[model samples]
Target: GAGVSQSPSNKVTEKGKDVELRCDPISGHTALYWYRQSLGQGLEFLIYFQGNSAPDKSGLPSDRFSAERTGGSVSTLTIQRTQQEDSAVYLCASSREGGAHYEQYFGPGTRLTVT
Candidate 1:
């Protein structure tokens, strides 16, 4: 009955450092999505994974960003060589289905700060 859980809630890192943020989706949800939201910006879709099949890494901003989902329930977002521009709220959402699915619940997000 859990909604979604994200770790840290806030992260302060130095430039060029790497950070890993975690997300736990609701039980029995078959789809998971990762999105990045900057201040006053819209949600940017990073990647999505369903079951054990291939993942959609379409919106990954650069090679410095990557993510993986395990057991179709939990996911990790890794930002390599973090930059000041990379400092933003990393939000995670999940649904029981994808594409046509709406009302995807979101996590509290991990606010990454690069200083």
Candidate 2:
């Protein structure tokens, strides 16, 4: 499906390393989201971007985690000084406008393993 796509499907980094994850949403979708999933845990919302509005970044766990959307199509999530606890599946999702009620399509996550 041409829904959402993520790069570097798997990543391995040292505890202090930094990693950048990427997401590409569907052609016309207006909402993009990022989530993190630990083993055996549910998806934790990280950030959200809807159209040209200010992004909802309250869900980000720490200042070290940040994301940016360019041209409303591609998004990049950068994790600085990655720690062992930061090892998780980084998932990206996108949906058509209508707020949270609309169904979102998820991308295959980037599995980050911090050693």
Candidate 3:
């Protein structure tokens, strides 16, 4: 994809289940980040990967959440044992090699709704 891509724009899952959302970044972007935006909330950083390495993952809410980058261009976020409170818009963004200060282009996110 020319821009960021995310799958299952809407996901309805039961609590205690697992879900995997995918992301495809731009051609040359080496930095990818995941964030969650709860309803009526702002984007909360979850994790970031530079190429195939995840240098920062301090923002994951619990052990149930994890993400990985593959080949520096694609990424996926997995939420295991989903909880009701985990419902939110999972946004994937990418930037050309730069700091968090850099503006990132975002995907249309996977909106997870745990019921």
Candidate 4:
């Protein structure tokens, strides 16, 4: 069985550019999460999707950040007007439905660099 996966493992773009990151969670997993890790900073939760319920976007830093999960399988995180401060490693994880005690399997992550 496949674990979580992301696309465009590395992205380098000029400031103000828009970037889209993708994530594919494991089959049968109904919970997915997105996180960002800035230099010297801890992993920051961005958003989460649980089955067909509404997504939790409270962790998004700003209006420029948004995400969506389709068919409860794949998700996409879009960043509008990218800035140098947005450079970081974006990680995605997924887990089976088991309340708050389930462990999430993490992907390798996509490194974004805004120059």
Once model 3 is optimally superposed onto the true structure by TM-score, how far is the C-alpha of residue 107 displaced, in angstroms? Answer: 0.4
Query: Distance (Å) between predicted and true CA of 110, model 1?
Result: 0.6
lDDT against the true structure, per candidate, is 0.91, 0.94, 0.90, 0.94
lDDT by residue (tens digit), candidate 2, 1-115 = 4768999999999999889999999989999999999999999999999999899999999999999999999999999999999999999999998388899999999999999
Kindly give the number of clashing pairs for every candidate.
0, 0, 0, 0
Q: TM-score of each candidate?
A: 0.95, 0.97, 0.94, 0.96
Residue-by-residue lDDT tens digits, candidate 1, 40-110? 99999999888888999999999999999987778999999999999899999888877644669899999
lDDT of 2 at 9: 98
- Per-residue CA lDDT of model 4 for 1-115, tens digit only, reads 7889999899999999999999999999999999999989999999989999999899999999999999999999999999999999999999997356899999999999999
Model 4 poorest ten-residue lDDT run: 93-102
Looking at model 4, how many pairs of residues clash? Answer: 0
Per-residue lDDT tens digits for candidate 3, residues 1-115, read: 4889999899999999999999998889889989999989999999988866645899999999988887777888999999999999999999988586887999999999999
lDDT of the structure predicted as candidate 2: 0.94
Candidate 4 Cα deviation (angstroms), residue 2: 1.3
Q: Rank the candidates by TM-score, best first.
A: 2, 4, 1, 3
